[model samples]
Target: MNWRKRFRTFWNRYASQVLRKILPRLESMAARLSSTDDTQELSEILATYKMSGFPLPMSFTDVDTVIENALSTGVHLTEAKNAEFALAVHIHPYPSNVLAVWVYVAVLSRKS
Candidate 1:
């Protein structure tokens, strides 16, 4: 039995379903920011804005670097703290290349 193949198929299917659910929200957010004439300002806002209702992965890190890179006309992830959970965003410029930004939101857990 090809377990790897099966796992790949399952992962792809799950990822597609998640993307279908999330793409609309992302598009809406993009549209809202599209009115801005300044790309730098847009990038800054997107990097700093706190996202809500997104099921972020628990293996996220490197958020500050991402924000800095995004602000400096590039793509990267930033570490907001020293843990998992991050906000990832990509900036694509027409007639230019695409820049990605990732913001890692550290998980603050309280042990019982």
Candidate 2:
């Protein structure tokens, strides 16, 4: 299998476990930042993830890649990329799941 498939398989199995550890830290960091510069802190978070052996995907390393991935997902994003971490809101167009809010956010990493 390709790296993407492998990564997806691994992610499907371990994402919850990893996210349980990651999300809280990120939330706290963001909350603490308030209004100051966030670049350094965000980079530090990514580095900490790397050091923890659960490094994030480097595919959306740039704005172009972020845009490309968003476009390729088949779901239309409500907003465009504007920062290192962009949340592509995917509200289902179908009537059945109209209320479903599926967020697809990619953290822009400096790796690769």
- Write down the worst ten-residue block by lDDT for model 2: 6-15
lDDT of residue 78 for candidate 2: 20
Q: Report the lDDT tens digits of candidate 2 across residue range 1-112.
A: 1323212211221323333444444434434633444345446546533311222222223455645654565322223232133342322233544332233444332343
Give the local distance difference test score of model 2.
0.36
Q: What is the C-alpha lDDT of each candidate?
A: 0.32, 0.36
Report the error of model 1 at residue 17, Å: 13
Report backbone clashes per prediction: 13, 0
Per-candidate RMSD, Å: 13.6, 12.8
Q: What are the runs in model 2 whose C-alpha is more than 4 Å off? A: 1-11, 33-112
